[model samples]
Target chain A: MRGDVIALDVGGTRLKGAVLDERGHALTTLERPTRATRTPAAVVESILGALADLRRRPQAEQAVACGLVVPGIVDSVGGRAVWSENLGWRDVPLRELAARRIGLPVVLGHDVRAGALAESRHGAAAGYRNTMFVPIGTGIAAGMVVDGRLLDGDGLAGELGHVSVGHEELCACGAKGCLEAVASAAAILRRYRSRSGAELGGTQEVVSLAAAGDTVAGAVWTEAIDALAAALAMASSLVAPEVVVIGGGLSLAGATLLEPLQSRLDSRLTFQRSPRLLTAALGDRAGCLGAGLLARSAMAETVGVR
Target chain B: MRGDVIALDVGGTRLKGAVLDERGHALTTLERPTRATRTPAAVVESILGALADLRRRPQAEQAVACGLVVPGIVDSVGGRAVWSENLGWRDVPLRELAARRIGLPVVLGHDVRAGALAESRHGAAAGYRNTMFVPIGTGIAAGMVVDGRLLDGDGLAGELGHVSVGHEELCACGAKGCLEAVASAAAILRRYRSRSGAELGGTQEVVSLAAAGDTVAGAVWTEAIDALAAALAMASSLVAPEVVVIGGGLSLAGATLLEPLQSRLDSRLTFQRSPRLLTAALGDRAGCLGAGLLARSAMAETVGVR
Candidate 1:
């Protein structure tokens, strides 16, 4: 309980690493680009390098275990990265590799789920037992906590992005009408560019244009909110979470995204409990913080106290 | 653990009572009409009368506890029937009333959730840890088992009935486009009558006519199946249950409902896992059986062995 731990959240483009004490307070944090590492082996090497760098920090001198989380289909129990389209990895035994190299016990988990755990325990969703953490970024996914337990239907429980919102837009997943096809950050930018024949660097640009009274941007943004509300209404109908923590890139839109989305979801619901919608408080550091908690748990389990 | 228990399922129209031995097999079953019991007090008397009748049976000689399940909002842990639109009750302490009269401890639960528990434990959803028991009756509701625990989102989880399925139909709950508005057995009958200008005694009559190649009946049935598939596809995306057990009066349609629903749900999915659709095997007795299980658990708790 007195030792520090090393934590890493390996995303598609960057590795967010942290050294944290047993209480989940970060002692030192670091971020490194993984965009240049194109292959699975290169990504693994980058992860090892990041871990080695963190270990060299004075704060991590007594690090007892490491927690590694990655995007895509992760087999948390098996300590394997099953598949990740963005990170370009499949069936990599990440825990074993890191543990053997770093000489510490390791725990593996899904990045989004880890973020959800962090948010539920210490951020916006804290105090709510049934919570949903939905991150709308390059892609959309949800991490749900029901009855104070994270739902892991074999790592397939929270595919909120893929549920259809009654749209005809084709999704990259070879399906039509997926929420991701219409409401994700990338989807919003793509829709805006195609409809207005104007280029925008990111979804925030479209949000700004919409706020500034651009009709085309307004229409695209409205469509995205509508799709998101439909998906959330469906989620509320099914699980009835007490709080929905909107995270990832689009959540940076703050009230611009949440206000209209909340009203729309409220209008759609009748008998189902309306979940309080809030922006994630931990911002982008949630995954790394959660990874630290996972490492702490691993250490506790080893000491037969968890 | 060695004693029998009395179980009662209180519905809007009837009270189904059962005396069960330790193994959950019904030693004796009885049914009584509650159609004349219009007020909450009258309904309570009807329930007590039914319980008295069941207690007179030889199978109830060693009954130790009673499980009472009612329709509508239930506070299971508080042993209260919070509200029932159907039974015209509000904040009734049914468990205390029943326990005092019967001279035994009592457990209370929601009827649909009880049916789900029974189906998951001993019926269609047996052997599957992640299962959804959706009974499409006069009304539609779901009982979900996630990670081997029944989700009690403050008794507000699993309102699959009210989720919109892209229809314009107005539901009894004052909501438009609800799944219950389009897909419940009652909705199917209403749709058939409004479309065909024919009066049907039951939803099964519409099913029979559809099977006999009536175009209007076929259209109504197809619409119901489409709406169900849409709602279920959404459920799969959210919870990713391993199996979805279709119960209630609609399941009597058997392969007619299951075949097209499975195909339609399959067509809606892209990357999410498809849950196997199965019919409820316990028929109308599921609620009664589940109540017995609840009673058994209460007795086990009293013995400090659960």
Candidate 2:
């Protein structure tokens, strides 16, 4: 229980791993290409290799547990990766596999949810009782903490990306007007491309153009912020969280995103108290840190029962 | 602890009370008109008189606790009635006042939420882990239970009436496109009266006309069901509750409301699991039963600590 933990964050394009102390401080980190299209088994092997690499380190060799985080629906209670539409995984017994491969107890959780847990426990929302961690990057998802408990909702909850916000745009989920279709960083870039017929480099390019007084870019950025504000306001009204922590690539816009979002949310909400808006502090390391916390907690529960 | 409990359910037009056994079986029940327009203090006096009438019963003197359920944002944790626009009461320390006058421990809760708690614990939703108690009366509101815990969301969570469903009609809350504007019993009657140019007696009259194949009533009823279906479907997709218990006056429509609602919800939801639809079993006694339960639990908690 006192040793370090190895954590792996499996993303679509990257496999990120870290060896963390009992306090969730990263001792060492590693990254490799996910290569998801090349067999699911190969991706698993790569994750195992990353764990092995961490285990070879002198300090990490004494790690007590391993934590793995994956995108999509995770049946955490059953310790299985239930489904991942992006990874084409269904009913993957990820926890058992990782434990067998690593020769240690393994805990698994949804990536975004794990990241939110990390932020809530050790980062920006450390002292807040009620917090919402929303990662708005390629897609939008929220990890909600209510009364100090992270809400899993039977693995089907936290699909905040699919929540309709009255937009007319078509979403890849086959739903019209999803929050992700308008508010995610990918959505911002797509909106700019659609409006200006210019191939933008990325969301950063649109942010730069908007900052430089480009009307189309500015309009698109404004609309995205407005949509995000409305969605956040609606969530705030429903849950009344103490703080909303914005993470992922989009949050890099910092005050540019936060200022407009705060004003629009304030304007839309009449009855509810405005929640503090802040950027995530852990950045890319959040998921790994969160996974480590999960592993540590799981180990603690096991020891307590014994 | 072996005595009857006094329970009061305050509605817009009427105030109902009952002296109940420890098991929540009514020993005596009474009803009185609520003259809310007279003033807040006068209404409190009237409610006290109703309680006194219940106290006249043989079981009243044996009562150890009193429970009051009112329509409003109740600060359950603080034991205050924050606001009830319909009751015209604001920031009333209802629990403290009732406790001081009744000379017993008093517990207060939102009327619909109390009803839902009662239903979930002792009635229709007894065995279900997740349930949504939606009461479609003069207005629409819901008491949601997830993971066997009733969601109060800081006392403002159950405002299902204000959820926008693209109705494009003005609501009393000054919002356009509210679910209450289209699906509430009052809204149904209003729509029926406007379309037929005849004064409908109540929601029952509109239902009768719709059953008898009246075009105007049919259209109005269908629109109400559609709006309700949309809101329920959205809720289903988000929470995935095991069952949805329909309560309040509109639920008396029975299969007339449920059949079409079920079909529409089935059509709307694709990936989400559809919940079973059922009518509340406890009928009008639900709120009182819930209040009794709250009082009983509060008493137990106090006893446990002592």
Candidate 3:
């Protein structure tokens, strides 16, 4: 099948995109550096350039709708990007711009939420009615699916990383004890390096050292896992999800991460239903696929309403 | 107008009821002791007796459906009381039993959530689309309103009372440092009494003492407010509710509670949307009113589907 929708997952340093068939399967894919500069115009130009690149593809002719997912706050209902610190975007009319450029119906969505939608519908969280998708990359954020639908909360819900967990570390968000400051992939790597005074390549190196019996590495990992457990426990208490899908770079450690994290969450929880913890299935492609799903659903909704 | 629905808010010791007109105004009200006993059967009997008592009233002659709100982990969708430590109810088919006894359509809901629903529809949170109703009476719990709808999370959601706040007191749920253990009205009175070695009559007296410059009482109040601020901050980061309606015993303290709490929450928040914190409206009558709303809505849904 030809691409029936265009999906783009815009990030700080990269713009990943795909043209998806009706089933949301990617027919073709593209990637380019976001070329993020001080000016917001450069970011907008880059986004448009990415769309133009996709339009040159044979599959672009088949797409009737487009989904654009981006980092930071988005008022999806209003089709606006409320803010993105990385892109220096403030209340940019993203959906309208993308729709006009692509000549297709556009759906704007939060990147994490779009990934969560994709995971819930076609990835690890498939078949689960209530799911939380936490992607712990450079930072931690969540995409929640409640009663089998994405929960946007006016583009403000699912900032799991920002929730404080009583840690001593100062977070990038200028808050102390935030889960992201203590447990995110970037945080993990930075903390490990600061503690050991050794320059580590990334979160994977820290995980490997922890697994290989480096006591210092293990301690850092344990603390990160503990903070994550507290946040997850609180989340479960508020809106119990049937499954929690862990994505991002750290989840690549697989059982090394899930095993201890699950035990800590178990100890923290009481009467609340313990959720099934699983690694995300779609890998890095989750965002674009999720964008595809969002695009298709929006198109379907429009058709249904008429 | 005659009573079009019967609504009951069942507590551990009392059954409070109202006969509602089609518009949901209470045509008549009733209350009775639960007479809780050895078996779940006896408790069920007490509930049925309460319904029968209401049925005997002239106002109830026109009732076509009923709504019953109760304390416990309830699967409202499944019509079952999954568990209630207070009433020793386990796997009880509450909606079915009540429907059979009353010869009417029945809707079952969790008490805190019912109150929240009531508040959202007609009380403090009436105009807000996304709100969190946290009623800190003898215990703390939350009723979440997201995207203008109640979030049940399969009946396991909204256990804010049990969420750990890193305090010293152990919760009755067997969890230590829970919000309920440290900040509930019962906790405030008990902690103040323990500190001063005086048997206080209630939370109000403690608040009065604190207002009068009693250092011990003031300390207890400050600690409670701090815990609430942390929990609310976390909740805001995740759900970003436009307003937080605080109900229950502590709310009676009014500005004494809201003032310090608002400041603490303000300091804790980062990029998240700030929520307006207010005392709950509808007072103690919120539960029954919520039940009425639920009953009416259920009836409306039935009518709409047909």
Candidate 4:
């Protein structure tokens, strides 16, 4: 762990952190509640605290860089978190702040984009030159990599959740018929609860109920799968990716989701490339791992690799 | 004109040939019937004849390169025409064939993509790093340029026409509710004719009627504009292009199309970048100018620009 780097994946509810070795393997890991209700200053303090804690550990003593991935529209080139409704941070110069506090070069990226990079480098999409990594969590977004480079588009490129699916239902973002409202984990849970009047524990509970032969749950699950297929098919037509890696809580449904989605996407396509649908291998840790990769990339950039 | 090159834009009904000077100004141009019912080999001969005709002109005496642009899926990397339902060709080694016949380096490309390159170089989308060049003609297709380079996704990318817009009308591609079926010039003209019982000459006639306060034509025009906006908005969300250049026959509407498309796309977007919509600058000759650019690119490559 001599060339270890600190990596942090900050989400709305919790922050995942790791002290990653040069090889990108986590030497140690940590987590803390995001305290999203707190001010941006408080969040910065928490981030610094987490970094300092990692630096003090014996395995992380040689940490030379840091990568911070946040949930928002990040201007990676400008090194600013432009906006994040979930975190209540607007135009925060997080990268510069983190670099100053950590005394190291820092890389800032979006959460879903980081996951895409991690998956491309080490997980389900490894070796694929073109890949689409869709994380269907509380929301849906994609990290699209074309010609071996992950696209950031000034942090506005992967807003797949907001793409209209032509449904009548209104999304939380005030957009009608958005893919997120019909297919995201949050959407699925809310729909099941309202439709069946069942107090489901979570998305996991909804999937369980569907597996146990509940008609409402089954219908809801099928609808989510269909929406995802349509969206993915559109993505395929746009990017022509070799593979599509599905990640997030909903992806845990595994074959139940993949089987239908693959066939539906295939059916939608005429001459476009049919993507290989696969579940993400890195799971929730993908962002943390991607942060590590970003840190390594920063190190290389510092020494003038490009 | 020692650096002059021959550029050809082949369509289903006709093939256009131009002898371009070093600066991409056409020295001489000609158009001949495409003979669509002929075999692919016969089509290649027609292209060769056009090249010969251009080459024999005094202004084209120094032609050293060629660029051939055709409609449909094309693998520019492999120099192969993968499949073109328009030209009735499949897996044709077009580039090699053209080069052999013309005795010059030939660059093969898709028509819409060529138009995109031409627009980016000297037309409406000039100076933009990220752009979507969509031509809504007999069929719809997009030529996407990201990070200053046009994407060649194994010839499968940019099939924007085939994307479902949630209409119930079946498209010719065996898919229900495709954007092309509802928004393309052919689709528009057909819809106008069937609805109004008016045998319109072309999309121009439809637009003229709409401008003259024909309610059916106006409705058809509005539907086309809305569908175009939805698809372009989706393209913007995925690629975050700064500009969207509309080309082909429909672009002749100018402000009539751009005004509605811009506002509708703006309404569809949330946090995504709103693209500037503009009519193409090069008109039908965009393909010829793009071919010139491709020829220049080929010459540079031949001299080892890399």
Candidate 5:
């Protein structure tokens, strides 16, 4: 526990790693293509190779533990990846495998949940006892923090994207009208494409067209904002978090997203306190920083108890 | 602490009281009619008189605390009744007033949340670390228990009634298509009335008619159950609670409600664990028992600590 810890963040299309100090300040970082289509075992090997490369660095001998985070359901208590549709992994003994391979104690967590932990401790949600961290990227998900603790809910919680808001649009999940089907960045692009019959490059292009006063683009953007507001307002009424930290790709829209969304949420709520909406501060590094912090804390706990 | 504590449960139309020991066993219980249309001061006086009469018994002298549970939003952290639409109360310091008059410590809690606490402690949700107690009565609301702790959420959480579930039906809360607008017992009766143009006596009568194979009644029952299941399934995906305890007036429908609701919920969820659905073991007395337990715990915390 004298020096830094190694952290790895696994996403659907990319693998990111970092070596950080005790305070979670990154000393070095690396990124590699996920290539998940190969196999789960190959992905594991890639992660190990990344860890080994980090260990070969000049200060590698200072590392004491390893932390890893991945998308989808994770059984953190049992140290298993319960399921990851994106990673094609189920019941993988991730923590034990990482420990055996790296020869160091390992901390495992859900990617979004770990990002939320990072935000609560060192970024936008710091000082708030209750916060909802929602990341709207290729998909929509939330990590809820209550009473200064992240809610794992036995690893099945934080599936806010699937909460039905009744749009009647077909979702990839085989459900009609889910929030992720209409409000995520990918959904915004899809809606724009369907309405204007012009294949917009991405959500950013739609935002640019809306900024230039294109009616169809504006309508799609407005609907996405409305859908997000509806979901956030309902969540606020139920959880009353002090703040909501919006992250992921769509968040780059900034005030374009927050203004109408806040107004709609305010119109819907009657009795609950309106939570302040803010952008995530950690950006793409949140999950890695969070994993490093978790590893550091785990090492501390082990030593203190001993 | 050596004798029974006084517990009072204030509902929309009735007031129930009980004398209970530290273990929540009732020593004596009483009930009185409540007319909410009466003056608030008169209601308070009536409750005081009932408690005074109960305290006149020989076993009352050793009592050291009192507990009161009431409907609507309560700021337990501030020891104030924030609002009770049913009781016409706003910002009332009921806990302080009750404690001063009774010459003993008093605890206040939301009625449904208290019932949930009781269920988690002694009833269907017992032994579960995470539970959601949803009471679908005249209205729908929930009490959430996470990691064995009741989430008060600054007195604004647990408004499960207002969560939207795709229904376009207008709600009394002014929101179109809230869960309560479609799934509550009153909502079921309203749906039946609107469909058949016939006045049903109550939810029980509607259930009996449906059981007798009345088509209109069956349709109404089925719609309400579907709406409830939809909302509960969404909640299950987000919270992943170990158990969902159903209580209140509509729960009296028993298997007629449980069977269809469970099947519909199972069909909707894909990744989350299916929680055990069970009837609340504690009857109407749950609120008072939970209030007593709260009072006892608060007193012990305050007096036992050096």
Candidate 6:
């Protein structure tokens, strides 16, 4: 048997774990709160504990390797979590520690990049050699597959959110006019709340309010869409992907977002090829699935013709 | 014995041809006016004639293959010149035709991309796996080396010149505010001439005037540099190349261009990795050297592996 692989995706608020077989089918799944307010060492302990818990499951008995993906700047090759503002960590060697504890080879990856790999292999971006998977959540980040290879420029390549879209809003990164500052899910909700002086539960509520003819909601949503369009237009002109797979929390808006974004991008582009925009097929599971894929590749490299 | 190869770089007004050995050393070189105003067929004929002339030389007697690179949109896989506004051609199967006449396997490539390959192999960006080769001539285009592979997004990946950099000038491609519209050598000269009402001989004269404290010339030069900085900042965010090699006519300005560009890019970036700005080491011969490399790779594939 090729055996299964253990996959873990660690985000700011959640840790999603899965035991996936050769074909990337999840044999077993687990999820838990990250509780990242704890020390970086505590977070590391929690991750190891989750892996141990998953390993105890019957489906993970034959797991050949483990793949762990984390948000923020990751040194994938070095198997280090370089930096994570949400988790308050820097240069933690997660893979080496996990490999020693788990008694299996471990592969480390960036969350967004792993998600992109998963999408390219088994999700909406499958079959497209050049694809950009942009996930708009608390922040926006891009996972680019260029010429059928994931672009990892020392873990700094796919920072679409930080790129200025000619706006004036200040980003958390201390840059002005970042796409994330103006168009992320948190930004949209915050912008709406501040503009209308009304309390909103989430970005979805703002989208709903816009649909129901609320002026502030409509303006906020439109600006977000316009910002997204501007960023995508710049992406198209630079990378020229055949398609862009939109994912994360805000992607749930579906056609409400895709239609206007496509039109806006079309109007902005003159000589550049306009990429077809589609909502992500795998939803939030992409990162976990990508971890599974990473583990599988490492397994293949170890057991096959090296 | 591994044989030599014929390399041809087709520009708007020049056809640069060379016979190079396996080590990429040019044994013989030739250059002639492209006369691109003629029909596409005539252009094709001129290319074929150039190859024939190169092949007849004593140094090219044992040439195994030919690599032909041209400007405009190129389908490297399909071996077709998809489009070239300067050459006035579209969808011309130049590779297959040249192969049939030249009696050698012909590899087609985009001139700038081929130049990037040359730079990656033997020029300024030789050791860096991720590099961007931006040649600022009559127009601006980028040849990106991402993770040691030249990016080819179906001939649409590296149109950095067309990416909007918040300028209002009209571009030849009918796009307003394109980087090329305000920052290209031609654009800089035209803007200077229009503003100063002085008939300057070339871009160098404008640079000289700018150095001599001519306000109009200085403004045009500064604007061009600023626009370049904006475009490069966008590229740095998207690709995060380790180094950016600036080539083409304007690169002759050397430190005058590199110093200001580096500082401006530094100011614009927040969290992105800043790439080292370097001038092209191969000068104008990069494209021909890249063609030779392309031909060498093709030869290796034919004889060594599938």
Chain A TM-score values, per prediction: 0.97, 0.95, 0.96, 0.95, 0.95, 0.97
Candidate 5 lDDT by residue in tens digits, B63-127: 77888888888988788888876677788888887777777777888888888898999988989
**Better candidate number, 4 or 6, judged by TM-score:** 6
What is candidate 4's CAPRI-style docking category based on DockQ?
medium
Higher-ranked by lDDT: 1 or 6: 6
Mark the 10 consecutive residues where model 3 chain A has the least summed lDDT: A297-306
In the predicted model 5, the residue pairs found to clash are none
* DockQ for candidate 3: 0.82
TM-scores, all candidates, are 0.95, 0.91, 0.97, 0.95, 0.93, 0.98
Q: Please report the interface RMSD of model 5 to 1 decimal.
A: 1.6
Model 2 residue B200 lDDT score: 75
Q: Which segments of candidate 5 are over 4 A away from where they belong?
A: A1-4, A55-63, A195-197, A297-306, B1-4, B35-37, B48-56, B300-306
Please report how far candidate 5 places residue B196 from its true position, in Å: 3.6
Per-residue C-alpha lDDT of model 3 across residues A1-306, encoded as one tens digit per residue: 233988999987889999988887778899998875768888988898898789779978888888899999999999999998677889999889887887778899999999999899889999999999999988899898877667878889999999988877898788898999989888888888888899898777888898799998999899999999999999999889999999998899899889989998989888898888999999988999988888888777777732
- Relative to the unseen true structure, what is the C-alpha lDDT of residue B186 in candidate 2, on a scale of 0 to 100? 88
**Alpha-carbon deviation at A162 in model 5, angstroms:** 0.5
lDDT per residue, candidate 2, B192-232, as tens digits?
77777898777888888878989888889989988887777
Question: What are the candidates' individual DockQ scores?
Answer: 0.78, 0.38, 0.82, 0.67, 0.61, 0.82
In candidate 2, list every pair of residues with a backbone clash: none
Local error of candidate 3 at B134, Å? 0.8
Each candidate structure's count of clashing pairs: 0, 0, 0, 0, 0, 0
Query: How accurately is candidate 5 docked according to DockQ?
Result: 0.61
**Top candidate when judged by TM-score against the true structure:** 6
lDDT of 6 by residue, A61-107 (tens): 98988999999998888999999878989899999999988888899
Q: Write the per-residue lDDT of candidate 2 for residues A46-130, one digit (tens) a residue.
A: 7777877887787687799998999888888788888776676778898888888778889989898899899999899999877
Instruction: Give the better candidate number (1 or 2) by TM-score.
Output: 1
Q: Candidate 4: lDDT of B202?
A: 84
Better of 4 and 5 by TM-score: 4
Model 6: residue A286 alpha-carbon error in angstroms: 0.5
Candidate 4 residue-wise lDDT at A9: 94
List residue ranges in candidate 3 displaced over 4 A.
A1-3, A36-38, B1-3, B36-39
